[model samples]
Target: MDKSYDPFKYSSDSLEDVAEQISDVLKCPITIEDVNHRLLAYSTHSDSTDPARISTIIGRRVPEKVIHSLWKDGTIPALLKSQEPIHVKNIKEVGLGNRVAISIWKNNEVLGFIWAQEINKSLTSNELDLLKKAANAVQNKLLYLQKGKMKKEEREQEFFWKLLTGNTLRHDDMADGFYQLNKTMPPIYSVVLFRFTKPITEKMEKQLNYLLETTQLVHICLVTIDYNELILLVSPKEEQPLNQIKQFLRVMEKQMMQRYNIEHFAMSIGGIYSDISSVHIAYKEALAVLKVKERYLSDAEHLMSFSELGIYQYLDVLAEKRKHNRSPNYPLSQLEKYDNEHHSNLIETLETFIDSDSNVKTAAKQLNVHVNTLNYRLKRIQEITGLDLKNVNEKFSILLEIKIRNMGL
Candidate 1:
């Protein structure tokens, strides 16, 4: 091959022809992949090759472990940042051989990658320079593909808004829209939301997209951005979408913190559903969870789904109804009034006793007092309020009232 001749000087109709041309020039195997590591094309090679490339060619996507290894080893971060050809050392654990790769880029965004596997010798400095030129040429090749993707994203965003707003006419249309844009209507999915401390910038949005595209934990069907909210329609990559959603949240959180030192964000999800029409409900539930977190920031910090809210789900209604009442229904007023006069913890004792389900020993342990002393406090509480500790209904009502007061209702 003449060093003066550019392998990618002329245009090809498809990436496969380009890959073959690169392989023929460099005297090594070549593979082409999209930004997400989905195999777009690979050249026919009879030379020594690694299992990772073989698996990727067969599966049509890079295996999860190889992607993980690249991320962990800083190979992916280098590829994302640099335009020059990168030399990656062999990683035997994932069956990844030595390779020279370069990111195909447009306007500072990576469009795809071209990898040249080293079968025998290392890529010469000239070969690396040639690889960079090929990446530049491939950028032009990918321009048409990228424009098509951007147009498709515009359409998907419109349909996502319709799904969330319940503006669509029927489930069939919803399924058809999903099939058209995202390839398949997911069997099960959940609405997940992440609210940042501030409005997301274009740069942050790009980072989020990179993170989402690179993750294999969830099948992200649709994504849209509000002022500060990153909304997603996601289904499981493995099984049981609920747990998968939580796992994805954790991954996103870790990535954001590691990459950008981003700390101010909260994530939540709605109940998983099979029907595409129920996206509106899921979106609402996810919003409700975020609202609940804002109100009860400490208590609901670990709340992942609306169903997990349990009794807190309806607390607003109960609080509202109590707002109009003229008198306290479970008036612990006597206990309150007695504690104020004597400077005793009688109200605390009473609340603890109720919380413990009238279990004297448990309440005593919680209050850091002896069982006999707790019995004495219980006696005093019953005497002061004329309360019967044995009545289950009364105790339950008192607990509910206590919650309402604690919430400042």
Candidate 2:
């Protein structure tokens, strides 16, 4: 081995060339990935390649489970923290073989990683130094690719915002932007929003972009950041879009919480639309669902769409009317006062009754109380408020007022 060897001095004009060069020097299989585990390049390999490498190359990105395993085992974290090569023993459970990897870095940030599978030999200290050299050689090429990607991303963001804000009236009008970007609009899409408690950091953005780009389960048409919110235009490929979105949300929520210890973000989606022109409505609806979750966090916890809000969907309109008329909810106020003074739960019983669709048995079961107990409470409720329990209008009004009071509006 040359003592003063330089990666740049080798015959390499592209990342693929760098990969093949590294593989030739190390006599092993080689693969390269961006910071998000999306495969960028790999060297021609023999039959000695492991299942993990085969999966990554086939999918053109690392599988989620493999990525999860690497993160959980502390290998990925260590690689991110240093430019030095990390020797990883085979994690047979995740189909990983013995390998050595190093992060490609430009400055303080990691641009990507290069992996050399040790099929038959372990890398000596000098070879470890050689792997580090490979990382250095791969850096500038990755940066050039990244610069082009970022500019395309910026244009997509601009065009998306214009569509969302209703600047582009029809799909036909966006033909030029679509052609210039070399992207196709989804035939069907929904506006999905994730609200974070704090503004997203650059690291978090990279993680999110990685997830969206690498995952095939959910089709993300476009994504952008607005303050503390990460907005995505999701294209559900399944025949039933709602089920697809629900599954996507479950997976994303689990991933964000598990991988990043991120639990502060909540996900919501608007009605699925067939045309881009309806996206403004979808955007508004998504924002509405977000507001519902903000005001009634516990009650709206599982509700991801506007329709799921049920009677609470009219909270904004009700609130608007109250501002003008200022009519106090007399019956609900009386019940709340009685419950407070008696150390009772008359208010809960009433709300539970309404939520159970006025079913005494269901309401009693939900409250973990006896049917007679719930009935007696109902009798007492009617007595205190002098309110008719059979009135549909009255029942809805009570539930609406309770939700409003719960929101402190």
Candidate 3:
């Protein structure tokens, strides 16, 4: 070890530069790797390198064989449990020479590892002390990087929140914000709203983050609206946007249920919009779908999409209009009056008929009534509403009226 070498003097240097300085001071080759075994940096000196180190450096990942060997020898477990530097002699069985390694820690969290290889001779106590100092330097570097990353993510999350809530509307400003975050605004985007039956746990949040990071979608932005609601904005990397969105939702739903043990949840997806500035339009649609699911489709278990809302979507629109005294022209009120007077389910029967694809037998089975009884009720509904069941326009009008009535419009 160089007695006069000050590890602090190289504080401003890059990880690779720090590794080089450490290698020179310790008289051995050095490598820095993240917790996932991804190579971060390595010394240039390679006089006595092994195939494993060379391959790891070239691939930027430690190979599975080396990882398995390290695990089998209990080196990985020891490294993870220890804050002090560890010396491994005769690593030749694992296709490597003697080496010293230490886990980089910040606040007791293992961030990465520093490895010093002993090529020509064994590392002495002084060299081990120098390696430990290098580990501390790596720890500081990781801390700085982690803090920088967290700050960047915070800014991005804030931007996403504002954009989704309609606070930031200008196209140029939105684009600039994305640029600052080093993210590209996708040409087409959609929003998905998730509602949990219970408050989210820290483990659930970590799982959500992992899911988002591993998903195939491009340009994803996830933000928690509250303890029970989460919003995701994403663009499909594939060509079939709608299909891809559905597939993604299905996978997420299954994973949440099976992996996280979440039994009850709902996911609502919005229509895709082509312009980035219109993301709030999608956001609003997603919220509407969630509201519609909770109020109208309570039996719907996991997934709902804006496109699947059908007449209910128009009902929501009509609802807004009705609030302003522009009520929709539907004659379901006459049926409602008749049903209330007769204590009948005429409106439900009509809805079941439509929902069953106009199949009388299927509608009868769904309503748990005989075919003749369902036929008689349909005839009564037609007579009361003056709608012909055989007429397409009349059937559609009845369906729309039923939807409006269901929405209490």
lDDT scores in order:
0.85, 0.86, 0.77
Residues 146-225, model 1: lDDT tens digits: 78978998899899999998898598999788778757888888899999999999989878987887788888899999
Candidate 1's displacement at residue 395, Å, is 4.7
Candidate 3 scores a C-alpha RMSD against the true structure in Å of: 8.0
How far residue 303's Cα lies from its native spot in candidate 2, in Å, is 2.7
Which rank order by lDDT, best down to worst?
A: 2, 1, 3
Candidate 3 clashes between residue pairs 3 or more apart in a chain or in different chains: none
> Against the hidden true structure, what lDDT does model 1 obtain?
0.85
lDDT of 2 by residue, 95-176 (tens): 8999999999998989989999998889998888888878878888899989998999999899889878999996787766
Off by over 4 Å in 1: 1-4, 237-239, 329-331, 334-395
Alpha-carbon TM-score of each model against the true structure: 0.87, 0.89, 0.62
| Model 3, CA-based lDDT | 0.77
Best candidate according to TM-score: 2
Worst 10 residues of 2 by lDDT: 3-12
> Per-residue error at 187 for model 2, in Å?
2.4
